[model samples]
Target: MNAVTNPHILVVDDDPDLRDLLATYLGANGFAVASAGDGAAMWVAFNERLPNAIVLDLMLPGEDGLSLTRALRAKSSVPILMLSARGEELDRVIGLEVGADDYLAKPFGPRELLARLRALLRRSHVLEAESAAAAAPPRFGPFALDTLGHRLLRGGQEVALTSADYELLVALVAHPNRVLSRDTLVDMLRGYERDPFDRSIDNRVTRLRRKIEPEPAAPVFIRTVRGEGYLFNPRGGQP
Candidate 1:
């Protein structure tokens, strides 16, 4: 792929050897790679050339990965994959909660890291395409979505949403009148499987329904499917 089309990834790690290794592997695997040693350098590289995804280290010289993640999330929805050392499950969870889409512990295999990176990049691209598709004045219930501009309107008033929430909404709305299982939704939104007990998808859907449905308690636009999952009922809703 051309440089413009190739997914650009920023690898930010204090370890030069690891950084170079990641850059080399990612570059060889159809991605354009940029490297930075610390948070300041990461910001510099970010300003110079915005990457499609960031592989950020949890431990940095000045600003740490979590801080950087919060900072970036405040402005942009660029995909972030955090890298932490072994035995840092707390850090991993915090990373996810703070808008980092994925995390990998150190001493990880190059292949596994590559797989995770590819999965994240693939999900990002899918979301972009879905956003473009949803922007074309599509209607469901009292809600109208402008996918291109990433805005939702309810009763002609705009409704705010986070990146994750918007993506889940698009996935459901795009396939209205169908039952989407929790696992399916997870795959659609997260680009991977989760543990059976992981409830992120359910939580996101609940939050989305509250915003879009006039009565979140008895959601009309998004309905539960019992043992199956959830469905968007657009038959009686505005088109």
Candidate 2:
């Protein structure tokens, strides 16, 4: 995908009116828009042609956003922005936990949604460029990260990771031996503005450490720098 070109977006919502509105608005803003009414349609659309990002609605007739998110996480790491009614913080958290990058409460304006989508797509492009620039795989501690394939290998064995986790690890490894603040990691990993008091970044780092660290409690690869932040020790040499 060209950096200047518009992105392809999949909007999944059971509400026909809202789905149409989103498609129209996104199309007007120069995005190639695709719409799906439910998870089955979402799967078909994804299989036929993968979108750059997904706008998923939490409430659906069948196979709700959370289920679809989990299902998608099992295969693809496409960026997902979840939609929910106001006061559904639990659903938002679950969506994030299941691998959705961001969420927006409903009754939102088209402009706001477009802005969020653009931010995410822009971040995705940046990450892609960074990965492309790294010709060889990078090794840090027990993990060997294939930048091109976006796969992680631990102790010479492949380990599964969510897109968000891989991006967070890349961001940390990019500035090896340097501390990355939680706020910075949140912004880079979430592909959007960081929210105050959001614990998602910490949770993702913890999960990643569990997969790559010999002891997640006393992580050597990703170390806490006290008042600073987390550091990715490149003791294993850069690949």
By TM-score, who's the top model here? 1
Model 1 worst lDDT window (10 residues): 1-10
- For all candidates in order, the CA lDDT equals 0.81, 0.81
RMSD of 1: 7.4
Q: Candidate 2 — which pairs collide?
A: none
Query: What is the model-wide C-alpha lDDT for candidate 2?
Result: 0.81
Worst 10 residues of 2 by lDDT: 185-194
Instruction: For candidate 1, write residues 1-239 as lDDT tens digits.
Output: 11126888999999999998988888888889999999889889999998999999998989999999999999888999888885467877889999999988887999988867766865676566565565366787667888767778877788999988888877776677889888767766766546768888788988887787777888888889899999888754445
C-alpha RMSD of candidate 2: 8.7
